[model samples]
Target: MSSVHVEPVIAGAARETWLGGSLKAFREDPLALLCELHRASGDVAKFRLGPKKLYAVFNPDMLKEIMVTKAEAFCKGGTFAEIKRLTGEGLVLSEGELHKKQRRLIQPKLTRSHINRYAEQMVASTLAHLETWGDGQERDLAVDMMKITFDIIARTMFSYDSKHAQDQIARAFDSINHIATRKIRALVKLPLFIPTNENREYIQALRVLDDTVYGLIRQRKAESSLEREDLLSVLMRATDESSQEGMSDEQLRDEIMSMFLAGHETTAHSLTWTYDYILQNPNVEEKLMNEWKHVLNGRRPTVNDYPALTYTQNVIWETLRLRPSGYVTSRTALQDVEIGSLQLIKGDTVMISPYPLHTSERYFDDPLTFRPERFEQDRMKELPQMAYFPFGAGPRSCVGQHFAMLEMVLILASIGQQYRIKRSSTQGALIPEALLTLSPKGGLRATVHRL
Candidate 1:
């Protein structure tokens, strides 16, 4: 541990104000504001929301202390507390013992062996969706990727095959995403019971989401004797160590909803960004095509084929590095602890933004350029730990990382092998919007052609 300084005068004090210093700017454009703070004040900077103190740590070593070494001293706070309305007490939102137990039960289902079983379904679902697109057709690749990933998650998680069911789930999630965006940026926190239009829409979306998830739970329970390989089955059969009991109906709903939201949205946005970058960089696109042709040779990608698709994997990694959907994550200190030189008091908040870190010149060469080659093994090994955590780090890191990677690689390979996508003439420069996830501002418009 580095020697700590006690009660150091917080840097970036000039950025504060009488009423929530930097709060307005943060709400407007968090990424830009945080980046400015980093540039002006170096690695560790402190500001305030009224009297409440907040710290933004940009150094990877300090971030590791918060996420790994002394993670137990922190709890999910700020945005995560707000997200509980949508995720309930599922693994993503839970803390302490509950989080540990939920993670324990759910972890087995997301292991590589379990996720590998879904690879065929992932490719098949992607191909089925691609088949609906006509050659030379213009489409919003962002929207298309969302639908494709949603369908794949639906099938692999619950054996849900109905287009109607998939559409309903997608629509509900859309509403939820919108509400989350509003809530996160709203100057005044509105109570859900106020019956505002946004509140009404949020409730309605939750109703639809609940109906679909609970219906699946009931249907599964009715056929308990049947053997299934889907995630729902594994979760239903899992028993806690102490109680030897599986999750209740409501518990199942929470876990299923968490997986559905976390599983698809990030992966979809990542794929969308990947396509956006590939269209902008011709050389990268050519390399990706060459890799696809040489590896699978026109055959659709299977789980076995992913190991050979090195460039395709690198493309996904670079996309995540450049445009991580979960761009920033927050945690509140549960105890007074020393992080590097500063003393953090209990209840003080810490914000770790991967967006700025990924683009920092100190961490990477030519940070803004779209160069997938930076992810090459030797180069990657040279970078600092926690410097590139799109899925986060430590205990609360994304549980479905393997599943997401496989799905993205297979989807890219399958689509790239059959189609060449280019930006539409009407589409403008990519402007990233920091909503619930970092999505392209107006969606990614592109034209697709069969190769």
Candidate 2:
């Protein structure tokens, strides 16, 4: 176990104001605000948002204490609490024994063997979606990334194949994500019962989500035999070792919904950001094509090829390091616990944003530049465990990490094999929309050239 030592709080850490301390800055630009706070203060910067006390944790050892060593003393807080409205008691929001059990139940489905099976669908889905594109066609690459990832997750996880149904769920996700992001940054939150236009839109979106998910559950349950290999079927068939019973309909819904949100959303944004970086660095793009050619040899990617695709994997890691989709995650102290020398109250929220830690000069040389070689084997072993955690760390880390990684590699290689997506010269500087997920602002407009 790693021991956390208290480092002296820097004299000029960002402080809370009489009202909403730092909330205005956070709302205007969270990424910039977090970066500023870390630069101004050292590791443990204390600030505020309205009545909430927030400690922006940047030190890797302290992060380990909060996420791993003393993890039991904290529960999901900040935007995670707000997301529960959509996720319910899903893996992302659940706590204590329930979280443990849910993790046990779902972990097996995302194992290496299961992820290998998912790769086939991932490639097929990408290829199928690619058929819709043409040589020299211009498209919003962000939208393209989302649609293909949505399709991949739908087929690979649930065996769902209805394009119409997929589109409906995608639209609902858009509405829900928009409202959720607004609520996260909103100084004042309106209760769901108020039925304001936004509230009503939120409610309707929830209705659509619940209806679609439950309808799938009901439809799956009604099947004569539930022996399929998809994640949904496997989950439906899994029995708790202690209880010798399966999950309830509601439990399945929560897990499935969790997967739906985490499975596709993070990967899509990652691909978007990866391409954005690739467009910025021509040498990186050429290296990627060379590696793909050497390993894949103008052929489709497979699970067997993963080991040989080291550089390709490094690109994904570098992209994730630079623009992690879930840029910030938070945890509230579950009790009066002492982390390092700082005493945290039961409800004090500790915000952990990966952007600062990932981009810090302490972690990487020339941190602002996009360099996949930084993740090369020998260099990776020297970094701290908590450094460069794009998918996060500890027990509460992403459940479908393997699934996401393989999916990213296969999709990137597949796309690179057949087409080159370049940024449009007319498209001005891209901005990072620091919503729930960090994505390219106004979408990434680019031309797709067939190779």
Candidate 3:
């Protein structure tokens, strides 16, 4: 009998050489590496991101294989583990039967009809917050954008944010997001020292978030009723499987944590870039403003107002292309797969970088240029379906994509209807921090002038 030697399935096998300067070139501009990899290493390539090494696959067929055909073999990978500390086993991190059951229970409540009914709440909250802004003053839209979305999610999801709750949650969100956007996820296991003020602050802020979310879950249980209109009330009353058991206290806490964390942060970053782009590209801003003015006619926008707001939607979509909040998404390899020439092992990490794909020369013309017209329905046939996935692609895509996009477009239109913005020389265009999300470093400062 011949002895068999099997190759181990891991990062080492995929990368197969000394870490070298290849690792550093990768960390700074993985998207650039992806472009080179496509040309030099074929469609699939191996590289490193700090200590966490990876294989990047850009082929659409291979992408479908991992994200769809054999999704079960690959898990959520390392990032989800970091997020798990915050959201626990909620939808964002849970797998198997638990994930399926949770999705079923939550699906009805987030239906188009349900979300549309509360569209007014979303529009109202957005307008109310924007109204308070003073014209002819400098502001950081990144911070303000999140503040409003936090308020909207509070109203739409929980149905209320007591003055105290709002203050506490926002403060906690600031501390948590600020750190999460800058801190190195690989260092999460390191001991926390008091001298490490940033780490100390991060841990303290998470505690605050836990308390706030837990208290709300308790309150919802005590007060949940069929008559309530808010999402929290609906979630509290939701039943699983046989429709007898409502969410457990632990489950509810995790769900709320997922919402609290994901609700506003990414949307805020996208909106911030949208503002910067609209200001820098005056022609696009003018066209968007014209649409808003014609549609609104000085009246506040509501959910019913969405269809008439086509240009606004286009602007939002285009902004996401240029400054995607989560620039790259990843999946762990499950089965042996060959994408181009590189053969991937079961445990290898594969990157589907939106930045490179969105800006790829083969997929897009002058990928560096900003062009909102690319999304016009008539032009849809020009681009590949999987090429433009800012929210993501396949079953594992962000569930709240519609909700987030709705919030962003409506808020941008409402605010743009009343104000004009210019990039602040003092603040400059923000360079994003490569942490959990693509966050605007410092903040997105712009001069706000009343329209």
Candidate 4:
């Protein structure tokens, strides 16, 4: 620790005040600020948020170190701390031994073989939702994707079929997300116990969500002997080797809530962005539809068909590269360490903004272009490993990555086979907002045309 020297601060730090600096720009649009810093200061940059100093690392090697190689020296920080309020000590928020144990227990359930069984449900839910869309009717495609994904998660993950239950969970998530963004951006924090209107609403929303989740847990426990393949049942049956005990009711709630929030929101936003980009790029859409036509020939997509839909998978990979739903991942240094030439002290916060890295000229050729062909086998292997980590990398990478990708590919194939979506209005450009996940500002407005 003593051998490491203080790293150079990013230029312009001298002109920054306690409240000024990059704070204003960051508050307004963090993505823009990060891009600017990466461009101006090169790979490693440092800035202050009030009294605390933060580091932004854009170098692919450094990112790999922070996320993979020396990952043990870091812990989830920044936004994740805020997320803990909703997910508690679930796999997403847990650390050290608990995270390893929980991850090990849950890993088998999301394996390719296990997730393949959910493919039928994914296609069914997506097709059912598309039935509600009438031709020439303008719809918020973002919200529509959200509903479909939520429905898929409900039916396949928990075997929950009641529309009322789905609606309750969706509304609760919306409320929680709204409050989370506000709290994360606020300069000063307010105690949750405060009787303010926002705080009160947060509590109410939490209560609704808790009631729904806990009720499901109780119901499942009552029927523990049933043979079910749903995620909830699998988790209920998962016994920790050391203790030979399954999770408690509270732990079950936390894990379920974590998966619900993570699985549904990120996938929905990714699909929304994928559609937006496809509509914006006709060639890609044409190629995708051609593949679907060649493969499915107007029939529904299934897990077996995924292998033949090569171009559709490429489009999804491209969308993830351009507009990763989990755009920014952060960590706190647990011990003083050297990341390349830069030295980080214990307690230093490090931010890895994949949004900028994916768009940077250093990694991809014509980084801003919507080119799916870049993901072709030969070309994709040409790039550095960490250059396009939408789901992150290493031990803590998203556990549901396979499940999410399969869902996206299936939904795209099913919907793309049936309709051609076009932007309803050629007005303003779509704005990206950082909420719980990266989502289009307002909603993606488009009209569905039956093919």
For model 3, residues 257-375, the per-residue Cα lDDT tens digits are: 88766777788888887776677777887788788889888877877788888877877887787677877667776567655456778788877777666666777666667777777
Tens-place lDDT per residue, model 2, 1-451, is 1111112212232455678888877877787788888888888888888877789988888899999899999998655767888888888889999999888877888899878978888899999989999999998888888888988888888988747776778788888888888888778988999979999999999899899889899999999999988879988998888889998888888888888899898898899888877887778888889999999999999999998899889888888887889898899998999888778989988999998888788988877777788877679779888987888889999988888999999999999999997889888766787777886788888999999
Model 4: runs farther than 4 Å from truth? 1-15, 224-226
* TM-score of every prediction relative to native: 0.94, 0.94, 0.87, 0.93
Instruction: State the weakest 10-residue window (summed lDDT) of model 2.
Output: 1-10
lDDT of 1 by residue, 40-96 (tens): 888888876555578899998999999999999999886576677778889888899
Whole-model lDDT for model 2 versus the true structure? 0.84
| Model 3 bad stretches (over 4 Å) | 1-40, 49-53, 162-168, 178-188, 191-196, 224-226, 242-244, 335-343
Per-residue lDDT of 172 in model 2? 84
- Write down the lDDT that model 4 would get: 0.82
In terms of TM-score, which candidate is stronger, 1 or 4? Answer: 1
- For model 3, the run of ten residues with the poorest summed lDDT: 1-10
Off by over 4 Å in 2: 1-17, 240-245
Model 1 pairs whose backbones collide: none
Backbone clash tally (model 1): 0
Instruction: Quote the lDDT for 16 in model 3.
Output: 25
